[model samples]
Target: MDVSSIAVVGIVLLIFGYGLFKRTDVSDAFCEGAKDGVKTAFELLPTLCYLMLAISMLRASGALEALVRAVSPLTEKIGFPAEVLPLAILRPVSGSGALSLLEDILNRFGADSFVGRTASVLMASTETTFYTVAVYFGAVKAKKPRKALAASLAGDLSAFMLSALAVRLIFG
Candidate 1:
């Protein structure tokens, strides 16, 4: 470890040892905190389950595929490879689904193909915005995550655009 981290760890151990010497009831506070953490985890479980089921249903219902098809022509017009369009659309909803699509593309078209390469770049650089921010912040009971969610989506969009442009310029 770095010198600062080592020093910090040493200081923490010193303080902890001193706490034991002074016989402070720190254990009670830690136990209480752990109890609260368990309560919070239990409270969030149902919400997390619902979100997972909903996302899974969206994937299985072919609604995601419809979305992909609807947007395919526009993306194609903008010079994105048509084959990668489904992954681009679904990437924000469910990461596993997106990765499946990307893997299928790579397997069928070959990893070095333009479509596979572009999807890899896009997937690598982009975040699973809607699934991540919405589920995480909502589960955590954050009151004002609207701005954070917007920013995450914006970043994903920017990365998606950049990946598309890079692929088109470099390999189209």
Candidate 2:
């Protein structure tokens, strides 16, 4: 119907056609990609464990609770749902920690509910924060990613703002 919709259809048709005619190395390529993904996962497991442990420690220390309370007033002013305040605070530092909070919220409140819908949108658009940034840049051995990091982090902030607004508008 729309130009973008037509473009997507065209791309899918082209891919299908190419698969029918070309010397396809799909299996080999797919296997290689899977292998690379497995390798990356293995390499990152230790880093992931350390991050989770540190985040757990922060949660245990009560500092995270205090931090959430401290920012609650400001986020309240900006229209963030009170229910999402904990996930919002945890999102920037650790993805697993944030997801645990998000999952609990989603389980307690249905996905169609304001808090769950907000979490869904926020999770989709935002990065996994420090872990992703560190691993991606470190993998590439990038020295200075000032501009790139700014752009990525700016998008995360925009997602947070837009998701909050969307939740209020759709379910408030």
Candidate 3:
């Protein structure tokens, strides 16, 4: 097997050996952890589903396209490729939607081209901001998310602008 495969096997063996040395019930511990994980996932399921449905509805309503048109001129002037703006806009809201837009951008502009590279960088740099906020904040049962949402969006905007700049500086 390859080095990575061997390394994974080695790690698992090491963990098992350590558990034996410690006289711990590693299987029971693992089962308990898995049970807790399932519980957490179940707790977050409704919130994530609601957020995803809302995002899908917004996209289907053409609001995404209209927002892109409204923002395109300013982004273009700033040297950001307007072609990837839809990815930028959707990325903060929905990862699947952003990934779909990224595929379109890469297909429309060949993957090695400037716009594609910029989108690649942007996709790498930014987070699924709303989804993260929904999951983490919701997990903690935080009643108000205004501050977290604002901070995450600010981070996303910075990443979006810098992704284009980084590609231009690196590839040009």
Candidate 4:
């Protein structure tokens, strides 16, 4: 196994040993934690399902493609490929959707192509902003997340622009 795997194992063992030393009921503690996790998962399930359904509808209805086409002019002028615009837009909302789009880009433009490299960099740079905010804020029961959502979307835009620029500078 890799060093990181070994480190994780060591950490787990250390925590277990510490619990034993403290005379804590480790098994009961673990069970309680697992129950809490299950409760949280149930709480988040509806949100997750809604997100997946929305993504599917967006793709199936061709709304995503229309949005890409609508932004093509500006993207083309900014040196960003119109083809990867969908990936950039989806990256902030859904990781799996963006990943599928990335795979399509890699397949269509060859992994070694400039577009492919930019997409790869973009995938690394950005986060699933909406999904993360939904899950985390939902977990914490935060009702007002406007400021956090705005900040996360802004960061995602910056990462998208920088990824495109960096790929161009490095590869060209």
Candidate 5:
């Protein structure tokens, strides 16, 4: 195995051994943790489902494409490729959706093309902000995440702009 994988296994073994040495019921603790994880997953299920449905409908309805086209002139003026716009929009809400769009960008533009590289950088730099906030806050039962959401989205926008600039400066 790779060093990282071996290190993780070693750490887990150490923790398990320490628990045993401390006379802790490790198996029961593990089972309790698994049950809690399952409960958290169930609690976040509805929000995840709703977000997936919304992302699907957004793509299927051609709204995303229309939005990209509508903003193309502005993006072009700013040296951003219109093709990467969908990735920027979808990245904040859904990782899988953003990945699928990134794959499409790579396929259409070629992996080494400026647009493809920019998409990759943007994907790497940004977070699935909405999905993360929804799952984490939902798990913690926090009702007000407006500030966090705003900050996360602002960071995403900065990442999008900076990725485009970086790719252009380095590759163009």
Candidate 6:
């Protein structure tokens, strides 16, 4: 097998070996972990559903394209590609949405082009902010995440704003 497979097997063996050495019931521990995973999944389900619905509505209503067009002039002056603005706007809300946008950008612009490279860098550097906040805060049942949300958005903004410059510097 490959090194990765062997490494995974080694890690699994180490965990069980340690459990055996400590006189712990590994199977029971595994069952407990599985149960907790299921619990966490159920806890986060509602938040996920709400997020998906919001994302769908935003896309279906053509609001996303309007926003992109509205911001195009200003973003173009700042060295950001207009084509990538959609990905930037969607990145914070949804990973899958951002990914689809990225794929389109790459396919349309060609990966060797500036737009593709900037989109690639931006995608790698940024997080799915709302989705993250939803899952984490929803899991903990925290109602107020204003500060966290603000900070995360700021980080995404920085990434979006600088991605093109970074690609120019790196690839130019």
> Which candidate gets the maximum lDDT versus the true structure?
5
Worst 10 residues of 4 by lDDT: 47-56
lDDT per residue as tens, model 3, 79-136: 9977788788778977766766676678768999999999999998888998888888
Q: Pairs clashing in candidate 2?
A: none
TM-score, model 2 to reference: 0.58
Which regions of candidate 6 are displaced past 4 Å? 1-70
**Candidate 6 C-alpha error for residue 164, in Å:** 0.8
Pick the winner on lDDT between candidates 1 and 4.
4
Q: Taking the tens digit of each residue's C-alpha lDDT, what string does model 6 give over 13-65?
A: 99999999999989999999999999987876676666657656776798866
Taking all chains together, each candidate's TM-score versus the true structure is: 0.55, 0.58, 0.61, 0.61, 0.62, 0.61
List clashing residue pairs in candidate 6. none
Q: How would you encode candidate 4's per-residue C-alpha lDDT over 58-169 as one tens digit per residue?
A: 7679887798789889998888977788888778877766766787678878888988999999998888898888888888855789999999888888888888899888
CA lDDT for candidate 4? 0.83
Error of 4 at 103 (Å): 0.5
For candidate 4, what is the TM-score? 0.61
Flag regions of model 1 displaced more than 4 Å: 1-70, 135-141
lDDT, residue 33, candidate 1: 78
Give stretches of model 2 more than 4 Å off: 1-70
Better of 2 and 6 by TM-score: 6
Q: What's the count of clashing pairs in each model shown?
A: 0, 0, 0, 0, 0, 0
Across 21-64, the per-residue lDDT of candidate 5 in tens digits comes to 99999999999999999998787667666665766687689887
